[model samples]
Target chain A: MLAKRIVPCLDIKDGKTVKGINFVNFRDAGDPVELGAQYSREGADELVYLDITASHEGRKTFTELVKKVAANISIPFTVGGGINELKDVDRLLSAGADKVSINSAALRNPKLIEDIAKNFGSQVCVVAIDANYENNDWICYLNGGRIPTEKHLFQWAAEAESLGAGEILFTSMTHDGVKDGYANEALATLAENLHIPIIASGGAGKMEHFRDTFTLGKADAALAASVFHFGEIGIRDLKHYLREEGINVRL
Target chain B: MDVAIVKYNAGNIYSVNYALKRLGIEATITADPELLNKADKVIFPGVGEAETTMNYLKEQKLDVIIKNLKQPVLGICLGMQLMCRYSEEGDVNCLGIFDTDVKRFIPQKHEDKVPHMGWNTITQVKDGLFNAELENQFVYFVHSYYVPVNEFTAATTEYIHPFSASLHKDNFYATQFHPEKSGSVGEIILNNFLKL
Candidate 1:
């Protein structure tokens, strides 16, 4: 039986770990390298590094950082946020990223998904869809939820799948930062419709949230930020909790 | 001993090389028949469509070269599928190193996802790539096509159903999962393979 995955996402800005992630016992949580290695040791199935650095010069150093992190950790890792074209993906992949998650770039040009998949294989391409519920419908947003798009989340996910996305990382803007629970309804719907793996993102604050996302949401993986980052929930403890809950998690 | 990773239109080769580097072993990534044949250990790895990769292998004469290698050869993911007798991935024939067929997993339950990507436990572990210590430890996997359980299966994992998590046939070895990315457990598997 394949164990459900637990992923910790680190948001990076200007080559530094942002979001004030403070692991009191771990001294170097602020450094991405130390943080990534720590999470891998704590039994995190995978890690996602989202580079939010806004400068062009900062982009060059970020690729180097990806390579450094990839060299340190052995588990599967995904890089997202600034990937805009095939060249960007190539740099990240060459720099040791197992997969590249494309969001706004894919929304801007759907062909980018097909192009990256064609060149690097779908296994290396991930489609991250940021969706928000508006007017009784789940609408997709672009540019980090700053810009809204008419595209529906369901339709975009399916389209991305058809365009050769190996996996879908669906992050609900509405559920994000709420820390109540995941968007189980939308997540389940996507899981029901998509053939590829659906990684549920957003609203994971507690151990039960992860359990619900796996059972009710039917998600293949549950990804979160603050819970693991702030030391509010330890991955080793969470895996133990999920195991006791009868959910098959990597322990 | 020199190890050569057969690099031919594949993926995860870099990761494999890095894993070996972690163990203080440097491996050469090459498709040249002479190098592959002469190496102490050879690894076949890829992440792509089987048909296109098979065609590329044939064009480069690697299809013949890989099949004839006498050294201990290990294949991962698509690399493992290509070494099988045939694959349903692109409805093409493979290297026939293992006596098994690769078939696409049809979801028995709605939760049975394709490309069974994540960490999973391996049971019935053999002593080849997987040692006794790693008998029931988890390994990372990402593939749509699975090699069904058969005589060559070294270990088995249940996704849609029990499938070949790792395979062994004399000097030839294969794993459906990525041992390079599987953390300490994966490192042990690779380390065991190197020891062989």
Candidate 2:
């Protein structure tokens, strides 16, 4: 009876939401706490706040913002980026993040995922794989998609699941910022191969993209950034569209 | 006025506190037995492994304290699973308050996934756990193990199959889903639990 989740990814820079064209060139979005509350009110199933530049001093500020957003919003939200140690996970979860997503750190040390899953339940830790279709196949990338790994996307996703990631956020670099559609083919492969939930990230242009991802990609959730932030799609209306398209969304 | 959340290395108890805060109620997270005993309502909220957490609770003697709590006690997710007679997780026995057994979810088909995560509707709600206006509303859930339908089952949800989504007996209530994360549907449930 689980409905497909619609998530809005807010890139946080100094506690404010920012929109990065593709993976760079940041533009001011708005206050994260305000946007998060609005998304929850507008029927966003979940939210992810990714700290873009996670410095030592600014980490505290983002943590405080997460606390504020968590208090203001009733729906669950997760915090990620620059989480390198167990203490960071503890701090974010303590500050009221429902879950913590690890990207570059997990790529560096898969055991980080293992340790987190061992300590906190696997349900709390999410492994986000930033990947791109390159050289005839999908290749995984790390460090904000700057460094490409030889690791195959499907193989690494399976490894992450074994390493205790409760969910996998698969963001396709090629599809990101293009406003075309989601990487439905790769997403479908991940969904079919993995037993855990697959959160399809990047490449969400219009309302139909979300519908296609759930139907064609078979993703458990579809995530977008600019589409939601730039007023291109209101979450309430998107859910209304999805519902009309025979998608079971909470309206 | 004194609502205490029993904390024992569990995950996401802060959201529950935050939910109560939105309702204009401030809850204290504590492991102190005396504080829990004195509170008007005690919420046993958790998101952690059962056996390891059970060991921690035993080490702190919170097992006996929780079983003996006279106030309206509500357990969430792992807290609810641990309240059962036994759990398949880590092959461990649990606090025997509900007299039901918790089983690990095994996907029946290739499409059916474990860790039945995301929003699902809870039907057949009873025992004041759910507001009447919130009948069959979708609530957020993220757990792998579930308590089967039993005499104490108050609400049920279907995923891989129909299972106990909520349980109630006497003054004790519990849920397999996270009300703190279920948006307005969850807020209503928490409000009703407080009213109870």
Candidate 3:
């Protein structure tokens, strides 16, 4: 049986982790390698390192950090943020990152998705969509949901799948950071519409929310940041909870 | 001990090299037949299309070198698929190291994903690369095509149906899942392969 995945996304800035994590055993909590190892020890199925750095030097540092993380962590990890072209994907993948996620770059040029799938195989391309619900419609957003786009969420997601996107990372801007839950209704629609795997993001506050996203949202995986970093919920305990609820989780 | 990873045009060999590094082994990633033939262990790891990769392997003569390897050889994902007798991916024949055929996964239900991309548990563990402790252990897998359960199957995983998660025949061993990306359980499997 394929276990529903639990991924903890870490924000990276200038090669270091941006958010303050609450793990006390670490020498430096900001080290992405250490944090990634800790998460792996705590039963995270995968990790996502989103480089939030703006400078070119910082991107180089992020690449080095990716090498360190890959050398230390055994599980799969994806690198995202500021990945605009094939060279960026090649740089990160050559540095040992398993996959790369593209967002605004993909929206800016949908052809980038086809290029990635063609050059690196479809398994390496993860299309991340940031969408906000407005006027009773899910509207796609750019630049981390600050700027709205004309593309509808479902239409763009379907188009991305057709463009050879191996997976879709859907983040609901309206539900993010609210601790309410995932947008299960919208997620179910995407899952039903697309053949590729769907990774549900943006609203995960508790273990039950994880269960809801897997069962109701039909998400193949669920990604969260603060809850796992701040020790609000432990991954082992969450997997156990999900297991008891009859969800197939890697325990 | 010298370890070599056969590198052709496929990707994801870096992850396998890093995984071996975590195990305290600095493996040489090369396509040179001399280095590959001299190494104590050869890892054939890949993540790409089977037809193009097979063509590249034949062009580089890595296919013949891999088939003649007497030392323990491990194949992963596309490497594993290419080791089979045939693949439905590109309507191409493989290296015929394993007496099996790779078939494309068809979605039986609305939820049966094509890639089968996630952590999955393996059952019916056997000797070569699997132990009793490794039974029912979860490992990461990401592939669209799979080799159905066969005589050489060392372990099986259930996705759409029972399929060969790993196969073993003499010195050649293959895994459909990425043992390097499968966390601690994967570490155990890789260690087992190295130990062989």
Candidate 4:
């Protein structure tokens, strides 16, 4: 049986780790490599390092950071943000990323997904969709949820799968940093619509939120940031709680 | 000595290269047959549609080079699938290094997800690739097709049904999961492979 994954996302800026509330008012977390190793020790199934400043800086430091983190940790780590071309993907992979997540890049050039998938294989390529509910419909957001696109969430997800994206990382903007929980309604729709694994991100104040995301949202993985970072919930205890709740977790 | 990772339009080559570096081994990624043959060891790692992968391998003549290699070789995920005799994915024929076929994990009921993604425990370990003390350990897996348990199966895992988690034959070793991502137990496996 495959165990449900518990992921802790690290937001990176200028080679340093930072966390923000609703994508602003950032606070320094720590060195990415150090935090990564700590998370690995704490039993995080995987780690996602998003270079939040990559786009603004017009260059990505994730490659170098991945090299640093991969040296100390054995768990799978995914790097994203400012990944626009095959060379960028190649550089990150060469530097030690197990997977590369593409968001704005995929929206800007849909063909890039197919190209990367063709060159590196789909399983190594992940298309992360930042979604928001507006006007009673799921809309795709770009530029770290600062800009909204006309493309519908389900449509872009299906398109991404067709283009050979191995998995979809869906983050709900509405519930982001709110700690109310993941947007279960939107996640369930994605799970039902896509054949690939869905990673539900954003929200998650408590352990019950994770349970709701997995049970109601039907997500393969639940990704959170602040809760795990601040020690609000330990991964071991959370997994034990989930296991008691009848969720299949690797103990 | 630099390890060579065959880079013929496959998946997860970099992760394997990083894994080698962690084990204190330098690695080079190359599709060049000469560089590959010159390396201390060769690794083939992939994730994708089998037919297209096979086509790419054929185009680069990697199919022949991989089979003729003298050094120890490791394959992961789709790389393992491609090493087999055949794969149901896109109905593609494979390298035939192992006398097994990759088949879809057809769920008898609707609950079975096509892609079996996440961690599962390994049992019946038989190869030196895994530390003897680490039997029945859990490893992460993400794939839609699986190689059925057979004579080459070094380790096995049970999902809806039992399947090969790792397969080993003379000079050839393959894993359905990403050892590079499987944490300490996985590192032990990689270390064992390097020592071999």
**DockQ ranking, high to low:** 3, 2, 1, 4
Candidate 4 local lDDT, A179-220, one digit each (tens): 999999889988888777899998999999999999999998
For candidate 2, what is the lDDT? 0.90
lDDT of each: 0.88, 0.90, 0.90, 0.86
The TM-score values for the models, in the order shown, are 0.94, 0.97, 0.96, 0.87
Clashes of 1: 1
Q: Model 4, range B77-102, lDDT digits (tens) per residue?
A: 98999999999988988999999899
Task: Give candidate 4's fnat, 2 decimals.
Answer: 0.69
The candidate with the higher DockQ, 2 or 4, is 2
Docking class for candidate 1 = medium
Candidate 3 Cα deviation (angstroms), residue B150: 1.2
Q: On a 0 to 100 scale, what is the lDDT of residue B81 in model 4?
A: 95
Query: RMSD of candidate 4 to the true fold?
Result: 3.1
| Model 3, runs deviating above 4 Å | A19-29
Residue-by-residue lDDT tens digits, candidate 3, A176-240:
88778999999999999999999999878888999999999999999998788778999999999
Kindly list the per-residue Cα lDDT of model 2 for residues B1-196, writing each as its tens digit.
8999998888867888889999999999999989999999999998888899899999999999999998899999999999999999989989999998999998888778888988998888885787566667899998889888999999999998899999998889999999998888888888888888
- How far residue A1's Cα lies from its native spot in candidate 3, in Å, is 0.7
Ranking by TM-score: 2, 3, 1, 4
| Superposed model 4: Cα runs more than 4 Å off | A54-60, B1-10, B27-42, B47-72, B89-92, B105-111, B131-133
Model 2's CAPRI class is high
